[model samples]
Every structure is written in structure tokens, then in C-alpha cells.
Target: MECPNDHILLSSGLKGEEKSYIFRPRFNYSKCTKCSLCRDNCTENAIVMFKEGYPFLMPTLCSGCKTCQLACPSKAIEEDRKEIGLTYVTPVNNNLTLVTGVLKEGEERSYPLVLNTKRRADIMDFDLEIYDTSAGTGNHVAAALEDSEFALVVTEPTPLGIHDMKMIMHLLEKLNIKGYVILNRADLVNDEHIIPDYEIIGSIPLSDDIVQSYVRGKPVVDAFPESDASVELRRIMERVSELLW
Candidate 1:
């Protein structure tokens, strides 16, 4: 399938006045006095000392954790803000829009980008906002799911998948968000007894329709609405609507 004629991709940029600040260290040559303390104590090796008795910061190696600033006895290090990522707004249709957050290359932390993306999306008008968070129950995922009313977790029927699903269930419970599970490739295994306590909303069986739809870059519900997988997905959506609306 091809994109609609009216669909357009826009430049990624920050929208609001609020900025995300990371602890990028800036050195004051006058106040430094060739102490070498900031360079000597940097665990990331981001600070390098030159023969001229001055410290230089390697931008890529810096984690912006302020370790160098705290270690600087001469108080020469100053906190500077740097752009770590960009958020994009894409209009899917008249009724739908997609907001995406992408971290800059070599940046490790994604929480700030996710937060900024959420803020950008929050300003837009929408009756419902659906968040498709990244896999795993890390702090970034938690940050995305913080204000969510419920979470629909999709998992495969496998040992490792079940273990990870349990971890996510625990995280959702801790966050006080109601959780529901949907088993993908349900026909591949008969291990339902080991499933977690979360309610199983739908079980999608392995289907060639799903595979072909994925290969064609089309949704199964749109490409093959009568297919078994699509039918199950519709049921799941109905359940979700009942719970949410």
C-alpha cells in the first residue's frame, strides 16, 4: 500500500518554550587556574587536558551527569544546555495525528525526548490519545505510561515472552494502571496455564493473512477484514472501547 495523496511529512523540531537541559560542562579558563581536577575526576573520560594547562570537553563522550562539575574544586565548570533530540508531528488524517520523539545520534538517555514528545502531543486537540510505547518496562516506558489509564500489552506465547510480560504486568500494577494482555501467535503454543494474572482480552492465531499484510506494508484489518486475525483484533478493540468509553 502507498501513503495517501494528502499525507505530508514535516520537519522535526521542538514546539514549546520549555527546553530540556542536560548538564553539559563549560569551563571558565580564568577561574580554572590549571587545577586539572575536573579532567582528572571525569569517569567518562569526556574531559581532556592539553599541554597548555587547559581542559577540553569531548562532546560525544559526555553523559551530562555533572560529575565533572561536582569534581571541579575550582568551580570553573558551568552547566550548559544542549539539544539531545527532536519531536515530529505528522498528520495521519483529519481525525488522527502521530507524534514521534527521536534521540540524536550518540545520545544514550531517551527520557527527556519522550517527555518532550508527550508535551508536544498534549498541546494538540484530540478526543483520545493512544501511546504505543517502546518494548520493555524501563524508566522511559514508565515515563510514557505515567498518566495512562490502561495499558494493552501484546505478547507471544513463549517462555521468554511470558517472563517479560510478567515484568510489565508488575510494572503496570505498581503504576496503578489496569493492564490487559493479547496473545499473538496463539496457535503456536498451548501454554495458557502459565499466563500472568492480567486479563486476556484476545488471542490472535497465526495466519497467513497477517503475514501477507505485513509483507505488503498494509494492516490486516484493512487488507483482509474477514481474516481470522482481523476478526480477533476487532473483538479486542471492542473490548477496549467498552473499558475505555
Candidate 2:
């Protein structure tokens, strides 16, 4: 696969353990045919092909930044962008669009796909955008929330959910982004540990109505606007808009 920025096919490799490995690129110049182009154009000096014909990428020493790709004439350098996944743009309504990045099956790296989707969305003009991120405090979630002005984290009321919520909240705070919590099944958990100052942006009590609407691919706001759950969602959106503006 070609690197999105450089459009070159240099090298590709896996990161992390076997069960959780992700495909990434390793820029190799030994495969390069004396391409001074990669050297001249490399912004990070990541592609260092010496006169003796030894080329190596200092990935840690190097940033994943793509300056060399622009300079390589041989098109020998490439990226693992495809190994990450595909991005799809689906029209939601007149005012909004839903852009999703689904990882190819068996692929372990989901962050690049999210990054690609966000990049595609960034160029388009839109009045409102809502990103439904995957559950986790990993690179994928980080990338999904990167450009968002505000985030609404949804969680169920369970011990595990609360534990993960705290971790996610810490991550948001570290990123210096403001976010609110939406308790998906608010009545299930005790209220003693719930943070008082932290905004309880919305609540959707466990209900057959909400589940039926979700199964029908309908937004709760559209299906049951008068319902308490729908009302809470709107209130949350309003609060989010206020913070964003």
C-alpha cells in the first residue's frame, strides 16, 4: 500500500505482540536505488541512505511525519495505511454527516483508520458533527477525539464501566479536553461515587423503548422526543453546543 503522504512503498512491519500486533512502515533505503530524492525531501532525515548504500529509519528517533514521501521519485517508499482500514462517508441529514472508519477484519491497528476518517471530515464544511467512538482508552479513541471540541462519553452503570470511565476521564483531562458523562443505565448503579461537579450530560435509563428505537436504526431524539430519555439527550446536546461555542 502507498503512504498517503509520500505515496511510496518502502517497507512494512508489525508492532506490538502477536495477538495485538499492528502493521506499520519501516523506511528502508537498501531497497532504495540511490534515491537522493528521499534524502532531499525527507523533512525528518528519517530516510538516511549514506554513500555506502545503508539506509535505515529511526522511527522512534523519527516521527511518523511524511516529508520524505513527497521527495521520493522512485515511489519506493510506502505506508501501511491500507493495513489500517477503510473510511466511509455516510450522509446523516441536511445538517450533519456521519463518517466512520471500520478496521479490516483481523487488523489490530484501528487508530490510523480513525485518523483517516477525521482527516477526510476536516476538509468538508458542516454545521454539526457527532463522532461515536469505540469503547477503550487506546490510540484509536484518542485519535477519534483529537479534533473534537468537546466529547460526550457514554457508559453503563457497572463497576467495570465506572472503572474505565475514570481512566477515560483522566485521559480527557490530560488531553486538556472537556467532556461529560452520559449514564446509559443510570438507575443500575449507586449514586454515591458519581462525581457531583462533573456534568451528568444525559441519562438513558434502561428501557425497552430506547432499545427498540436503537434496533430500528432511529435516533432516540427522532423516535421519542417527548420521552425523558430523548429530552435528556437534547439537553446534553444543548450543553455541548454551549461549551463548543
Top-lDDT candidate index:
1
Candidate 1 local lDDT, residue 187: 83
Over the full model, what C-alpha lDDT does candidate 2 score relative to the true structure? 0.63
Report the lDDT tens digits of candidate 2 across residue range 117-223.
77777877776666667778887788767766877878777877777888888888878888788888777877656543577778777766677666655666777
For all predictions, the C-alpha RMSD in Å is 5.3, 10.4
The TM-score measured for candidate 1 stands at 0.78
lDDT of each: 0.78, 0.63
Pairs in clash, predicted candidate 2: 6-69, 8-77, 8-78, 9-76, 9-77, 9-78, 10-77, 10-78
List candidate 1 stretches off by more than 4 Å: 1-23, 33-58, 65-75, 78-81
* Cα lDDT tens digits for candidate 1, 1-245: 01111112222222323434466988888888777888788888988888877999998888777888898888888878788866667765578677767667767777777777788889886789888787778887898889888998888888888988999989998999988999999887776677767789999999999888766666788789999999999999999999988
Return the TM-score for candidate 2, rounded to 2 decimals.
0.66
With a 3 Å backbone cut-off (N, CA, C), the pairs that clash in candidate 1 are none
The alpha-carbon deviation from the true structure for residue 110 of candidate 1, after best TM-score superposition, in angstroms, is: 2.1
Q: C-alpha displacement of 119 in model 2, angstroms?
A: 0.8
